[model samples]
Target: MTETVAEAVARRRQYIAGGTMSINRAIGPAKLFVRAKGAYIWDAEGNAYIDYHAGFAPYLFGHGDKDIDDAVIAAIGSGASLIGAGTMPWEAEIAEMLVEAVPGLEQIQLTSTGSEAVSYALRLARAATGRDTVVVMQGGYNGWSDYVSYNLMDPGDVVADHREGDEYPLRVTTAGIPKVIDTTVRVIEYNDLAAAERVLARGDVAALILEPVLQNVGVVKPLPGYLEGLRELCDRYGTVLIFDEVKTGFRHALGGYQAIAGVRPDLCTFGKAVANGYPMGVVGGRREIMALCNDPDPGRRVIIAGTYNGHPVNVAAARASLLRLKARERDVYSELERLGARMQAGIEAIFARRNYPTTFVRQGSAFALYFMDHAPRNWRDIALHNDNERDLAYRRAMIEAGVFHFPAATKQSSISLAHTDDDIDRTLALTEDVVRTLG
Candidate 1:
């Protein structure tokens, strides 16, 4: 007999420590997803969902994208799972494409996951600058590394003392991190140039890292001249500027958000949609800084190594994804913008008649619904004013109604290249129904 959803959930809980691989996966109602194709996912019990979550914004072209899948299948057929000894053609191909695309990426190295890429970037920065302390945004999520796992979605009270030029108390996201790690990190609110300068001016800081647009907390975009200001400050202070673009990379543009912003960082990290959901991460930037990974002097080398660092299958998928993005750049981005605009407009109209305070914030194909009157400027703004309960409740309702929005406050919902006008129409209708019953 096949196991039911309940049985599967129970069995998972019995074996898995938290019934999920990642703690973030614990959010929302559980479902046993049997299969997924294009813009839809099917549960084991025959229920289908118009998937807006898109595996945490990785599926830019949608699930089981033919171009990426075919490339992966071809790589598997080549019978070169892990040569482990020398360079692969796919690695060179993808690296060349990434360098050509991203503005700051003169050279790049791959990792199996974004978290690992971030770790390597930080290592390079520390070695290059000869400084141990690092600075990061208060609400930004830059992988699970101890150096960065701080102040992601802290409570209002924890950040109540925050001021424009002051750093927030470091609220470590996980417990197992060493107490000494906290000493090296300083957290500041997004969009505050004064705070960033104050922290970086200490002259002991190694690197200042951030998501250019602050995506981790529902798209708090940088204010005018913010990126440029940070660039100037980093140059003045001799600190390495790193853009943790894992969430904002290819999803926003082929060259990553740095290309769009036109303010290049010394180093940038990428993953997720770069491979169209394949497990691949990239760290690239100025050739001098990146070359530290294979420095001639043993003392100067910042080592970067992984068994599956440039696995052929993953490299193939990334190469295919970038080629398709480059070939159909106009059609692809325009369609994504169209679909995203339509969804945002529909949601705005739905809540216009009602007295609910809501803001539909979007950047390119990524979007979020915050139950607040105005767009949030930073995490403290969301924590102090946004209605967390209502946002989560609305998302939970949508999930039950077969429109899969991650049922958590401030988590982004994605629109894929495969999402059709009909998908948007159905999503709007479902949004209306959920909004009606939200009370």
Candidate 2:
């Protein structure tokens, strides 16, 4: 007489396309999650799991954080949300906060989701450069808009025997995308400076956009000169460079990856942890480029409009989150670093003691476990070296042992501010169990 998690998932699958709202639910058991609170989740079957997925890397302060939720509720009760007016007053405050905190971003425009931000970034680029082709990374995901739908390496990954300068055939992630997008977008492998230069030499690229760190595939860090090289090539080709930091915007530091890499893009997009689980995104860049969004000349001004672009409640949440970051910059960042280091050390120690051929890669609060001897340089390396089956095995075992991740293996995991030392220790213990069981 009682419905199980599996049963509920099955029933929902009949109506909900793909059985889940996001593509993530299709990876693991399609269970119905009932609720979540501060680094933990409960499924329909009443199983509790320590949540590290954090709703796909948005929960910096963790789920149900009172400071953020209270602000959201207060805004709504005060009639700040769902404002279909021209613009809310608090929009400027949040925008000012972002420009002040993040370096190399002089101005910004708001969007409700990361995908929309990326789309507008491309539009700005095309309008500024008067070019059609936009360059993208082979494995990097910049939202699911038609311009970026090609070459998504999840669920439909190719064998990927791609060589430098070798044209990897484009495969659209979904149907209904115009086939002509293949001509408008050029795909290049991330971290390959030679490939980047070779592609950009054509002098027809409107933009070269990618994640500063190729995060979709297990937090792949850029090689020492890779990011700097990209910046140079973008300048050489007059291509607008846009860094999509939807995942890394607020995790490692308040300034995003550019602060760490010290190489700035022409424009950058922010989402995920910006508002700490609130639906918001931002497209920011140098003053000259970003001003194109509001250029006085009609021919130059790019159209960027959304009804909920700066919802007052979400803006309030962003303000609170950014203020917390600013006030406790040292303590919050230091603690996050400590937690990330602690988790990475524990996991590495396990692999070392167990004599398993595994590698660990981490960036501040974000981390990944690869079933390979060496860290991956890019997606091609991931395809050739990373042991996906073994990686999936460990991830499933950890989930079964009460640790929650993105479900699919390629996603990078994060440790939120809500995660205490005890939480890390328990997670490490569970991780050890999973590793040992896999053996």
Candidate 3:
């Protein structure tokens, strides 16, 4: 008996279920991804979408970049991974490139994902300083690792009527995470120097881990002198400074946030765009701090080990991607900024005309639109956002109008080197249409 095409498709979905696949939402019913190229993707039905999210801001060079593809292909032909404890040539090259691009990165360690990188960096900091406590900024996301996952949000814990000069206590995001972990971690608001100093002065804190520019909460930029002040405070307090550059790395600049901010961190974790969407992460910093990993006294050292930490194929892809980025570094950043500015300006103009309650926050080329009356300074401010319904409507309209952005209302949108002037113009036009539809 011959089966019909519709029946075959249904069988496939049943046999290999897609993630969170359901037909109830505004967008998820269409399981139609067929092909992708630079800045655009075609659905199984052959409909095209102008990709604005860039795989959650990783594909800086965009999808199907020939340079990265060729490198991966060549590496696969040679071998993907080596036998126990062997070095790959591309690993050294990638390390050197990262160190050169990032300031004061005398040593580097590779990992398979951003979470692993942050996890290892925190451990290294604790081991080096012999301190158990870590200070994390409120609303800053440093991956899904257990340590950083605390203090994200809790409706019960929020101070509804927070007042000036009042201490806001840290609240855990999830329940299963031990309350003792909360004791080991201190939470403070970003760009609040006084609050950060108070937390650091506790002396038990080993490190302060944060994204130099908060992308997860929205593209929230650090207040003037905030980063420099953090660097100074950490220095004075003998605490390790860590910059979680997972999202901003490579996208903000070739050297990552440290380069753009001109502030050196004791350690920095990078992922997302490290291999241009390939699953790779890196942690690097001053040699003295990193040397804690190689302490002669084994009992006093930290060890990071992973089977696919520096998988040859990933290293090869990273090396090639880094080289391509270096060659086109100026053009990539300039074009992204130029295009981002144009898009933001266009969106703002549309908002002004419609009198919509919306604002755009940008950091370098990465930006997010907050459908709120004022800019968000922290997660609490973000929680106050009331535009969820309207934002979802706008996102659906954009998707239906041939543009793809992050489904969430508060997440950021990335402008890639692969995006052309035409792509930007088209995106602006579609965005205007979506905003106009909101009225």
lDDT of each: 0.90, 0.86, 0.80
In model 1, the Cα lDDT at residue 31 comes to 80
What is the clash tally of candidate 1? Answer: 0
- Can you give the lDDT of residue 190 in candidate 2? 87
For all candidates, the clash counts are 0, 0, 1
Name the lDDT of candidate 3: 0.80
Per-residue C-alpha lDDT of model 3 across residues 1-439, encoded as one tens digit per residue: 6555455466767756542243211233344566888999887666799987776678888898898999999988977655646675667777889898888578999999999999999998898788998988777889877799866643423745543223357666756887778678877777778888887887878999999998976788887798999999999998999999999888888888788789989999999888988889998788988887878998878898898888877788788888877898898788888988888887788787766688888875688888898887776677666376777677777888898876766777887778888888988888888877768
Candidate 1 global Cα RMSD: 1.1
For model 2, the stretches where C-alpha displacement exceeds 4 angstroms are 154-160, 165-167
Point out the worst 10-residue segment of candidate 1 by lDDT.
Answer: 22-31
Q: Candidate 2, residues 1-439: lDDT per residue as tens digits?
A: 9897778878878999988887655766566788999989998778899998888889999999999999989888887656576666787888899999999789999889999999999999999999999988877989889998877763324635577665456777889987777889877788888888988899999999999998889889999998999999999989998899999898888999899899988999998999999999999798888888778999989998998888887888888899999999889889999999999999999999766578899988998888788888888877777777877877888888999877666678989999999999999998888877788
Flag regions of model 1 displaced more than 4 Å: none
The pairs that clash in candidate 2 are none
* Position 234, candidate 3: lDDT: 91
Task: List the pairs of residues colliding in candidate 3.
Answer: 32-44
- Candidate 1, after superposition: displacement of residue 269 in Å? 0.2
Off by over 4 Å in 3: 1-32, 153-168
